[model samples]
Target: MSKYTSFPEPGDDHNPFQDPAVTQHSSNTEYATLDLYNPFDNKNGPPPPAYAATAPSAPQPVVPATTPPSRTTPTEPRNYGTSFTPQTAVNATTAELLRKQEELEKKARELERRERELDSHALGPGATRQNNWPPLPTFCPVGPCFYQDINMEISQSFQHTVSIMYYYWMFTACTLAFNLISCLSLFCVEPSGGVGLGLAILWVLLFTPCSFVCWYRPVYKAFRSDSSFNFFAFFFIFFVQVIFYVIMTIGIPGWGFSGWIVSLAALKTSVPVGVIMMLNAILFTAQAAMGVVLLKRVHSLYRQTGASFVKAQAEFATGVMSNQAVRQAAANATASAAQGAFTGAAR
Candidate 1:
């Protein structure tokens, strides 16, 4: 047996360490020869060499300590590079949604508050829990002239006093139109008919605009603004309007050519003219009635506002005393009266 041989040949069954090739390979690779009795034991391996030659070592990379990335569920998309995680993004989105919802709720409450305030303002101080106006007449006998309908619309569109004033004004206008038509019809049938027609047309054109500017508009403004000055102005102008209407009804001929008397004079020759005159009389009567009604209504409203005769007198005094023209006129009148008295004494 050679000195390097650590085991017997493979065919030698009596010896348990038998494979020569395995023994030789093990010896070349620096492993211990297998002991057959303790082949599976860790203690059977050869001991390490006592003296190992140290070699110049290569520099090792300084690697940071890192934990392995946790496994994510297959359904979740992996985020790269960005610091925002899926849970953090979800949390931020939920917060933003909640903030927007809160803003919307706040706006809704504010809008509701504003709407309530507007409704209260529109209702006015005198508004009761129930509506003030009478309900629509269920059985309209006149077959729907739309009077009730128009009244309802006006009530909805305007304040209570304004609605009443508007109705009064509307009736006044109707009566005025009837009177005008009657005047025109009489003039058409009269002698010197062309001149009469021209005068009637001119009267209509001038008076219609004048009436609106002087009376209707003032009344409308008075009711709408509830201005005391405007109300007084309306009362004076409407009084003048009523006086003019009375004059026209008397038929002075040249003034307005509107009198029922002139129309009655034409009646002997023309029956239609007499009928028109009668109709004009009726319209004028209606206009007068409406004027009285409106006056009463205005007075009632004025009283409701707590104004008295004393207040009216004060207003009148202020208006008169404060006017430069009035002061000048008074001064002139006083000087004239003094001069006249001095002259009379001299005589």
Candidate 2:
């Protein structure tokens, strides 16, 4: 075989095995057909040579020339909704966390303020509380003993109710004073009535402070602190006081109250004294009526506060157990009993 072999041209009818005469006769016509068949003559120059036709670099993908995309999106044709950027998502989450932190800080500050109020009321060390009641002069020998300020200590909702009670207490004191004057008038009319006058004086001295301490202070504390035990205490003591008011309004002679009966009897002795006694009776009756109204109002408030006897009992028990004096007394009693039993056993 030759190193350089020419391929057989197209359209030759004779092979090498055939006669050379037939091959030579077909060669000219084949050559002429091939020479005239210019595949790219008028279109392109010529077809590429065989050597020039390679496997072709894997057809390079048509890449349209692209400029860097515009920072602003095109605003025509199709509507694209706001696209979410990572920075926007990050900022939204950060803002939410900051809002929550601010809320928590506000809550913490409110809690701290409430704690300070409680501490002040408790009269703890460094407390801002001071005695303001009995509002005596600075130069007075006796200083104020109680810290009492409805506007400062009581809640806004309760201030009106508490103020009424305070005024009622003052009214009660005034009634006692008038009762004393009425009894004095009766004593002037009848020397035998001196006993009633003395008793009336004693009543004035005793009851004025007792009513305040027993009932008024308790209810005040109950409303201020929402203490169930204090509410129960006020109810009990005030009910008893109301009963006493009723008894006094009846004007029992010798018992010291110049009530209706005494007033009517005094009418036989002196018109002026009877009139004064009747006025005292009216005051006592008013006191009893007011007491009843107050009791009803206080009970309604207690119910609204959701305080029950069960809660009161629990509070009382806890208070007793927590009291330093009560605990010390209990400890001493136990020690004393144990000592006594040990001595007896040794004997």
RMSD of each: 20.1, 17.5
> Per-residue lDDT tens digits of candidate 1, residues 69-164?
886777556568666677988999999999999999978866665676577679998984433323445584433221122222222234456666
Q: What TM-score does each of the candidates earn? A: 0.42, 0.63
lDDT tens digits by residue: candidate 2, 20-82: 766686565434334544554676454445313532555878999999988685575453687
| Number of the top-ranking candidate, with TM-score as the measure | 2
The Cα local distance difference test for each model comes to: 0.63, 0.86
- Please list all clashing residue pairs in model 1, or write none if there are none: 251-259
TM-score of 1: 0.42
Q: Which ten residues in a row have the lowest lDDT in candidate 2?
A: 46-55
**Following a full C-alpha superposition, what root-mean-square deviation does model 2 have from the true structure?**
17.5
